[model samples]
Target: MVIPWLSVLWAAPIIGAGVVMLMPRRALAKWVALAVSLLALGVTVVIAAGFDPGGEQYQFVESRRWIPSFGTGYILGVDGIALALIVLTAVLVPLLIVAGWNDADNAAQRRSVHTYLALTLAVEGMVFMSLIALDILLFYVFFEAMLIPMYFLIGGFGADRVASSKAAVKFLLYNLFGGLIMLAAVIGLYVTTAGSDAFGSGTFDFRAIVAAVAAGDFAVNPAVLNLMFAGFMFAFAVKAPLWPLHRWLPDAAVEATPASAVLMMAVMDKVGTFGMLRYCLQLFPDAATLFRPLIITLAVVGIIYGAVVAIGQTDVMRLIAYTSISHFGFIILGIFVMTTQGQSGSTLYMVNHGISTAALFLIAGFLVSRRGSRLIAAYGGVQKVAPVLAGTFLVAGLATLSLPGLAPFISEFLVLIGTFTRYPVLAVLAATALVLSAIYVLWLYQRIMTGPVREGNERLRDLVPRELAVVTPLIVLLLVLGIYPKPALDVIDPAVGHTLTTIDQPDPAPTLADGNAP
Candidate 1:
């Protein structure tokens, strides 16, 4: 059973932030942050170890009446799915702090970074809680609370303050609009439930409402359902940074530093996809089915468009921004297929993307530290001056291209294979996106590392010991997850399979697209 560590886990990062603020020296802040993350990670591990795979109906659940006036409660729980992300958050935050050690920002900036790091951990905790928040309103609160730290990170630590803050404003406005719309949908869900005695008394419990809707006890117009689905999906897609609505991502990534970028690109971005899995499918299955084709179209478009644009990027950061768009396109493709393999692949992709992206961003950070610029043409033959650094980048970049032995390769393969059953033609098109990834990944590598050295590049040094401490674990994780993904998958496969079954759509039987069999 899932036991509630909601209080403990939530308290860890906030306390760590307080300690960091109190600590006088930068060295002490680093140690404090590391210690806090490790502690929280241990707690997450303990929660993971205690999780019972067979009994996944929200274990470690702690629910109490809190604000009965609005029909909400202090609710918390975790399933295998939420646990995986919680572990990912705990593992990544400390690594991000260590990765940022080489940043040349001023003392005030460092303070802001440390405080932001703490806030990120705090946000991660809320995201963790919200993942399993069974009550609708409680879930909404934790969900909206994540924006605070992210806004500061992008606005405060971004490369060009003016531009970064502008991007943050755009992101805030877009998401805020989406969130406000979703609130209306949430109110609708509550109002529909009000006819039942349990809900008529004003309860926001999701399970009861789902039961009421399913039994046709809740009289919701089909049109109303469709509108609600649109509201929720729009918010999630914007967050997923799906095409059309994804304009915020590239701009934000371009301006933010590696550490801050990791928060936005790696952790926070998953919220969109997570919302799809949890809300769209979980709460509005009919509407999700209705919207499938349109969403899939956008996903495939993003896949190809992102790849094409990335190939033309002149700046490394901008190129990475586009590459992520290309990659998440596959993720959404897998999710829409509505099969066990597809959903599981999408989940695995979320985790693997976090690992691969952290590596790529960190590598970008190293290059920036040396060249003082992110333009691809700003330096060449960096390997001559910093062989270790270039080699690390090569490894990371190959992984980005989904090199066969790396982490992304396995997850990307699973997603593509999963999609072949439900979307033969789209899956075929998705394969081309991988090819484009290879072209740009390698192209980026060659442009920056293998050509003739440019002037002023001779002074760049290989990764120092401190930097290695930050990067080594991420690289090792990529390899480890690639070769032996059983631990992660054991959690993912069953969870995703269970989740898909919960939705209106069940697994679509397979038909091999490569012409092996019908």
Candidate 2:
């Protein structure tokens, strides 16, 4: 029965993709994606309802043979962490589709509706499966599979198809090259464990490797593990678009439709962070320890740099893209801090970011739809015309800036608390970025949503019923989760605790910029 349920979770979105592709009307395509997202989300909730948080091993797990000779099988399971992301994916997919309901205003744009819809569904399915994969090879497969749909999303459904395609290719190349390196590393890992296979064959089973490491059946030298870790981290770094590698993100986000931007920046982008959680910690604990300082440094730099750049951006979408970089910085810092609080915060940050970032991107889409521009200066005093739209924008803007009652505030606060215990100076520096975030987010809000009414701005209309329907749930979730994050944090804490325990490392104590470890 669980197998049946897992199969539905995997297949439902794909089926929706097919349905959308088959439908003649763009309207039907939109609804098809929405229905599929809701259906998959429904299945996910049911899985959570049945999931016992106390279960040590993965529940609702299903494993069946796909390649008998190769010792490869289709194995899937959900612990609390994967399930949380699955739920986030389910929530955002529909929001993206609904947010972009009017994105394609012309014939050329209309033609892309089905393809974009289908690709989004496919990406959702792939990402969900990737998070649950027990086998390393399977995880890698699904991980790379996500790039396909996202490539189409950014490339095909973008604001300028040519620019989008170029960015897509850039995105694809950066990811694929990283994947190839990881494949070599995966193969190396498989070969190293080839002799221990009970099936008289090598495998890419993640759990098996963890067991092997624990049992001392094989020992990985720190150096070799470091190499593989580099390959894996390279892939995830590009995906996370960490600081220096983040150039591609702003370009792609600016070029993308709000739906594409939301899923890309919020959903698909989380894949990078997820990979760090699952792969870096699971596969390369020693390397993680070895590289923690460097990665943490990158994370802090991204936090400050991203915030500073966001302040300078005059384009709405570009500013949001930069905010993601800053948010990711905090998330990465928390994860690498390797403290219970840090890991928990990082996990919570992922879920909260999904809600908040997706909402911001969706709001930006509506603004563009009305104003026909992505420039921040394009309109003024829009509150005079569209109070509802302006109000929603305020919520989203405040949420992005991590205002105290919003979902991100709690998560970001936890990250700071956790990171400070291990990296005080860095945490303080990263904390400074928050003040800057307030500056950009509030100033951007004031400039775009308030102040003097422009000469032609009086015609702007408030959020309509359908648009309100899409935004209302996200806003409510934002407030509810903000005030009471225990429900999400409960599931998150255990997984993060387990992850840190598996690695068996305490966070390093905070110290000065010099080598002194106080």
Candidate 3:
């Protein structure tokens, strides 16, 4: 039998966290955490090596009973999307640890670094589990459980601990409320599935759930399905922090450390969109179709609103937060468009965004650390003083703006092209944000990095080895993906096709000039 790669991918960090808690020397915990995260990355590489890019089925699947009475089991698997996300989670956690090497100011606080590392590891483990989980109950369990570590990560460590605590509380409350609503949906789905021929027997296996929904085996009411889909969609929306429901993100991201923000924004938030693709579109195709127009409207609104708001922000971190809101809008739009290019573009966007956003946060955090400020006004002529740092920022910023020859551009272009074929007006409206993105990013760079040296800003340091170490990989990835995306897309397309097939949707063919096949 093949090794249980998914279990190993998740368990390494939890085991590492346990070992970290036992470490006699507190300083060693970060190293241990880093080693564990790297190990997880290595395992993911092995999984990828063995992964069949052509296969649409979940790979490395392993299932065992968790609660017989509830028909719940510890089911785990990954498609290309899940594998890519698992890799992202693994890649980011170690960088997060490194970024926080000296986060605590006092000896007392320093002693608790182990706790911080342990909590981070816990989050990594849980996130991996959430990505790979094939049981609805197990998915929900990991989904909700990962938030605890994040709450502490935000609250316990940051530039403003007290304010961070408040943000954490807000984040927790929002997610928990959403999760509870999802729980009701899960129960509702379970009840609808009982005695259904589609599942063979009552089970919380996600595949079975999908099969039941697809076959119309469950005699669920349309109204009930709509309500359940809304619940699931809302929970994910809150997590995506999509407009209106997105209020928690700026607060949490602004208050949290750069590392925390990386996890929160770059890694964790993708779970929300991933759920929309995985469960909502695939399992609740009717509801997804029913709600497409509404979701598309919200996504377009978020794109323009986030870009406009970002242009007005003074705080660097908060501006990035708002920009994420805009980027997420694109991802959402791409997903709801339901075209092959749109789906593939959205999936690719998730990975590309994570890498580019990490470079922004980490480099920005490094700048903030040296200058002791996050306000754009406080920084001036930084490029003159630290050209390398300025260059890094420029590359990352260009990626954010979806400049050609960078990763986001390809994905963004694909999204718009695919969307235009089916959603012409929406595509045009959403494309306006591209100009807005350029304004905010270039304007921010000009204000912070290009002006005459501000008082007390003349002596700012360039990117240190540690900071470079943290950011280099992400930068390399952005360029590599921009230049050559086919490897990733090869893995992603089959899964995208599977999802579209499950939803019984096909890409809309382009109309010929003569209204005939060319």
For each candidate in turn, the TM-score is 0.94, 0.95, 0.97
Number of the top candidate by TM-score? 3
Model 3, C-alpha of 64: deviation from truth (Å): 1.3
Q: Once superposed on the true structure, which residue ranges of model 3 sit more than 4 Å away at CA?
A: 105-111, 195-197, 513-518
TM-score of 3: 0.97
The residue-by-residue lDDT of candidate 3 on 254-337, one tens digit each, is: 888888789899999999999999988977899999999999889999999999999999999999999999999999999999
Point out the higher-scoring one by lDDT: 1 or 3: 3
Error of 2 at 15 (Å): 2.3
Candidate 1 displacement at residue 475 in angstroms: 1.0
lDDT comparing candidate 3 with the true structure: 0.88
lDDT of 1: 0.79
Ranking by lDDT: 3, 2, 1
Worst 10 residues of 1 by lDDT: 102-111
Whole-model Cα lDDT per candidate?
Answer: 0.79, 0.84, 0.88
Candidate 2: clashing pairs of residues: none
- lDDT (Cα, tens digit) per residue for candidate 2, span 415-508: 9999888788999999998799999989998898888998767787788887898899999989998999998888888888778777887666
Off by over 4 Å in 1: 1-3, 102-104, 107-114, 196-200, 211-219, 510-518
lDDT of model 1, residue 270: 84
